[model samples]
Target: MHKALRLTALAGLFMAAIAQAATPIDVYRDPNCGCCKSWIKYLEANGFSVNDHVEPNMSALKQRLGVAPRLASCHTAVIGGQFVEGHVPVAQIRDLEKHPELAGIAVPGMPAGSPGMQTGQVHQAYQVIGLTRDGADRVLASYPADSSL
Candidate 1:
């Protein structure tokens, strides 16, 4: 009886953990962009839930979000209070969560090797940039171009 009770308690704790996890991120993307879909798939594969919206005016949205012209990407997401732009890797996303000091992160442009943008050929090296609401930018992570995967 004691062993069964302990197992039940453990299961309850596990369920509670899952229940307390973060909710689906609010995503804004153009309906006609396939790569944005791919990026969403990448997030889903990494255990993220996305509340997707087919944004009609991406340019205005990006501008309002303070995404600099040079740091442009295909999609935008809101997780917690921080923004995620482009095809940022799952690891970088988790890191951003860990460091709440950052206002947001971005992968900038559509790189060939990014999770959803992979074409199965050559991969392009890219940087995941951290951005502030005021337009400051810094490199959060750098991925070297490789096709080994």
Candidate 2:
């Protein structure tokens, strides 16, 4: 009976490792960017494993990843073959994961109370925009979704 319990525990651990290994997201940012590090911490807090890629030419990298200048952010991410631009929330990122049909999502500019750029009581209502590889964009999720803040 004890051996069976031990095996079950081992199995659970193995499965957990597999789960962690599966959802690796690549993050590209400037090496000098502090906000980018904060965003990475945010993703990690939401159970994502980030592969950091520091690129000196962030503008060129964003262009290469198909993130439109209008929807650009300080950092960019690639997850499950989709581009995620800017300081997008973890919930929105999770939603994007389920919708592979969409090319990507973006938080546009750095809002005052965004995950990475947080300050006390500073709430700038921002919109998370959905995008296609061909440059079309639409509002995907609005921050403070209810606008009660």
Candidate 3:
């Protein structure tokens, strides 16, 4: 009986952890941009709960958010205290969610082969950038351009 009780308690703890592990995102983007909406939908499909805000001045928003010009994109997302820019992959977002110590991850620009911007036969190599609060950026990972995927 004690063993069963302990197992039940452990399972309850695991469930609570999973329930609290979900990432909440706040996205800022152009009001009429379809790609940004599609990206948000992709995030939603990947288990993120998004709060979206449409803004006319995405450039100003980026500036205010401290996103470097080189890392700028069509939309910006704040997730788990990190800033996610552009059409970053859902896996990368999940990585950021798992590692809360990093500042954020960004895709810089809209690469042709990104998740939401997949083209029929056009693909471009791109890097996901990890940013620091002091404006330092590092390449987190490089994803090959795979439009054929």
TM-score of each model, in listed order: 0.81, 0.82, 0.77
How do the residues 1-149 of candidate 3 rate in per-residue lDDT, one tens digit apiece? 99999999999999888657756789998888888998988888787778999888988878877788888888999876678899998878878866555667789888886877864567899999988766678888898866565
lDDT of each: 0.85, 0.86, 0.83
Sliding window of 10 residues with minimal summed lDDT for model 1: 18-27
Q: Which portions of model 2 miss their true places by more than 4 Å?
A: 1-22, 145-149
Per-residue lDDT of model 1, residues 89-116, tens digit only: 8888877777676778999899898888
Those runs of model 3 whose alpha carbons end farther than 4 Å from true positions after fitting are 1-22, 97-101, 147-149
lDDT of 2 by residue, 1-149 (tens): 99999999999999998676656899999999899999999888778889999988988888887888898889999988889998999888888877766789999888878888875567788998999756678888877732555
| Pairs in clash, predicted candidate 2 | none
* Range of the 10 consecutive residues with the lowest summed lDDT in candidate 2: 140-149
If the candidates were sorted by their TM-score against the true structure, best first, what order would they fall in?
2, 1, 3
